[model samples]
Target: MSDSVLLLRRVRERSGEAAAAAASGGASSSPGPAPRRKRGRRRRFYPEHRVYRARSSFLDLSEEQVLRRYRLDKAAIAGLCRELGADLESLTGRSHALPVAVKVTSALTFLASGSFQTATRDSTGISQSAMSNCLAQFLEALQRRAARYIAFPAPGRPAPPAGTGAFPGVLGLLGSMHVALRAPSENEVAFRNARNFHSMNMQVVCDAAGAITNVVAKFPGSCPNAAVLENSALARLLEGARPEGAWLLGDRSYPLKTWLMTPILFPCGAAEERYNALHHQALAALRQTRALLKRRFRCLDAAGGCLQYAPQKVCQIFLACCVLHNIALRRRMPLEPPEGPEPDPEPELPLQAPHVQISSEARAVRARIVQQLEFTVQMSCESCAEAVREALRGAPGVRLLELRLEAQTVLVEAELAAERVRELLEASGRRAVLKGMGGAEDGEYKPGWGAPNWAGGEGGGQTGPGVPTCVPVASLGAAVAALSGPGGVRGLVRFLQVSPQRCLVDGAIDGLQPGPHGLHVHEFGDLSRSCDSCGDHFNPDGECHGGPEDEHRHAGDLGNVWADADGRAAFRMEDSRLKVWDIIGRSVVVDAGEDDLGRGSHPLSRVTGNSGPRLACGVVARAAGLFQNPKRVCSCDGLTLWDERDRAAAGPPPAPAPHL
Candidate 1:
């Protein structure tokens, strides 16, 4: 047993003494009854009992501070907490779950500022995982109650008639906006847009008061606006049956449907122009609603940066924000101020041809003119016209311009009396007779003088007093041929007279891409030069380009035809404006792109509806009828061989052969 052995024995005795003290719950020298062991329980620190808890800061916040930070008043916040607690009790499954107030505050803070989960947890005194849970639950609750906040007007309360208000009979205005998002890992190509950015196209329908009535948030950014609407449940509802006279107002991006009214692509008459103006005014509400929604929830704005969630979660968040927006509107909460300068406006689409330029000075001078006088002046030659112009130049308050010697007409912009100008012109040795003058008993322009009655009269298809009320039923057909290209596009377009004022157009075009294409009747039937010989849309009434249902649309405006995934299109529609008698021998042209129906932003929209180049064209010919003759050719040049024979045999026919 040397010194090493003694050291070992001392170590062992000390260890044994320490073990005995631990078993007794205290050192032997300081013993009391070992602390009584609790059975089947573990001790935990309750934050509620602490003098200062992690969530105490929320309680200390002032009412105004809470509202400013969370966009909810004290009353609203408490209500939300109560409702959420009741709804989430079963899911949470905790007799003493996290306080409802704490969960709501955390979720609201995250939603209001779009902060990360870490930041939200730090500020709200909840764990990051707990914060995520709270937010998801809260969003779910809001979505479940969305119907309570957002709804269409009741059927019993019909919207007012058109022209009665800012957006008469307009239940909602439809539009789409982009929402930024992280690139999805699966099917990433489907989420990328032309700009190479990942996003979702959120379509919203807002009422006249700027309240969002419907929202579709699942479409990928690559989806066109029109496609999104066509795929939506709302589209099915509208297609199946629309509310009587209730329609949605949209921009050119949307297709013109019986339940959805878009602006005229080209405004021809005052009535169509008025419709366009009112349509724009009504659609503006959608823009304002989007602005307000993004302003209220910075999380929804691009400025806040893209949301770092999966597409499914992103959709949920969007819907939750919409629910909150409707709630804010109901509660009359003060919205957050706009965050920064607005983005620059989109550039205007280029016009097809440059408009005639007018100098600013000329415009100003024209604005000051109180009256204009048009007169027929007898001037023998250019020398005489020069003398009359010089005489009028010296007259007081008389600016004579645009002298057409061939037509013997002179226009004078003046502030003086018309009689005085006539006297001055007559004094110059030229007999002047007033043809027209401004500020007369009649308005600016008399009926059928300035603007032609394109549709003849409101009751269409009645030619004259002795003419039949109904035009004879007729049918026309076209063998659609591809334009001079390699796309191999071909189809047939047929027109069948359904009634005097209505006709059915049926078309089947193949060898095209899957999407909308412009289908229309052109003014000319000559295909010798391909589609070039086909003039602009057949606007016999001198009307603007619009949808088939438009009151003042071009006779050839058939709107858009959609192609299936197989590059085949089949279209059938009834139009009151098109008649087989009118369109026979005309050309049916298919455009390369969707027709904007003349309401597009491009200047060419006025004339061409902004549809791209012709893809296919064919001459519309009388299929089989009294008017059908394969060899017969008639044009504005006058009747052919058959007309001469008819006149010779009948001694003046009862009525002329229907002019082509």
Candidate 2:
């Protein structure tokens, strides 16, 4: 008993001693819940002061090097930094923001080189994610300031410096270029272009000084230039504003409108030839401007590789590049060497029939300037005549100058003022007297010299004085059949001759896929073997297959029809080719694929317009009236099953039958 009590006392004392040691150690060392784990500081790749210093001293690079690397001079970079500083600070947060210069440099590197984000990160010394964020933010800032940097000159302003001998009053040059990109996951076919590259078609309008004034950067690369122009805000602006006496010079890829001018298709006379020459000279500015833009911003170069971004993002990048280009021009930065080949000519589309009219006073003014003038010069010898000829030959606006020594007279054809010609002759030390103004009396002007062929009479070959004022109405019924399936597409289409050159076509077809389908009028009305029996497009003029509005195209080319998701397509278009009186008994066919309007690189484009197989067929027939209402007729001849059922239920109207 004595030994057990002593052991228990020893154990109790040891336990108390152990508990005290544990509590003291826990309070001093273990602490409470790890002290809530302090967030670790991010390791700096470079010293913060160094980053700040790098940004602040960005202009330390020579102007040439900066222009070569970033397509911006030191002044431009500085201006951009100052302009974007506040916005950048707000986006990145003042406390942890990267220097404004760093963000701008990252964006400029990407734009100047058209390099990928990873490449940009390596050059910028920033993480790829940070660079990406920086690019997005920079683009946003540029877009906000775009209006300030890029703007068209106001109406009545002096024309920008067009190339040598450019057209007068040309406000800007309109053109488009392709920006290559990786194919999108959806609608990849829609973005595949003639070059077989996925891209975006960017439309740009630049002043003669090569400064971009406007940009529309969202059209799919496969879209035709004409279609893009026709569907752009620029078109609406030109249409509504109709900037007085100002014209946008463009290549044939654009249509001829009052506010937009294109080169004459087939120039007839000297005046027309001169106009065409000037138009081409003016349009050269656009081509050179595009080349310069791509040269300065290599990211836009096709050689830089397709941009790896979504379509919308790619558009933003394009617009941002345009803004920077304008800014660079403002800062007088020299352009770099072009990075790729010049863009190819755009595919042709249906030409829009020009609706502009030339005023009589304007025509007279043109005739007066562009005319043959005969003047009597007091020349004594052949040497004198030779001297006069040499002097007139070097004149700026002279088209042709002839000096006759025997008659002592001089004849000149030019776009020169009468007083300027007199002064030139007088300066040559020969007294000259004006004889005739325009090689003939004012009332005896030649057919093609007074006004543009389009302004006077029917020049497009489709419209003439002999053409009827009103085209008759016509209707066509289609029995559509899927190329590979048992189901069929069916619809009725009506055509009305709205004017001498325009025919309005309205129809609805069911059972088509929800995409673009080729629609055309076939040459034959035969339906013996369905659409296959119908010949090729109704090309009576022996013309190429093109859109209905094309200057030289098959009469049957009606272009494309887009179907809705519900497999129904309703279309109404005013076609300049389809005269209601011309296509009677011909067949209308709907095709399986989109129509390339005869401009596709594929061989089938020449014949079938690259539209797949015929999916539906119908015969054209004369209609009693335009848009004849088909729904007015009775569905059933005043009788119904319900009426019969009621009569039967009422015991067959026995009393009425007896009275009869």
Top candidate on TM-score is 2
Worst 10 residues of 1 by lDDT: 439-448
lDDT tens digits, residue span 482-529, model 1: 233335677656554422344556556777889999888889988777
Candidate 1 Cα deviation (angstroms), residue 104: 1.6
Candidate lDDT (C-alpha), each: 0.65, 0.66
lDDT of 2 by residue, 1-660 (tens): 699999999999999999999998888775556557679999768654643322334566776777777888877888889999877765546546687898998899998888789887877777888899999999888888888877776654643322224465577888888888998999998887767899998889998778898888888988877778888877887667644446787776565566766664544333345566766776777777777777777777777688998898889899998888788777676676644565343444333343334344433333333345556666777777766866775566553345677876676654444445655775566665444433111111223333223344223433345543222112221111112223467655655442324455656676888999998888888888878889988888898877766687888888998888978776656576776656778888888899998888999887878999887777887543311222222367664422332232101222221211
| Per-residue lDDT value at 340 in model 1 | 62
- In candidate 2 the C-alpha lDDT for residue 297 amounts to 78
TM-score of 1: 0.47
Q: Which pairs of residues collide in candidate 1?
A: 265-597, 265-598, 265-599, 266-598
RMSD of each: 23.2, 27.9
Error of 1 at 537 (Å): 26
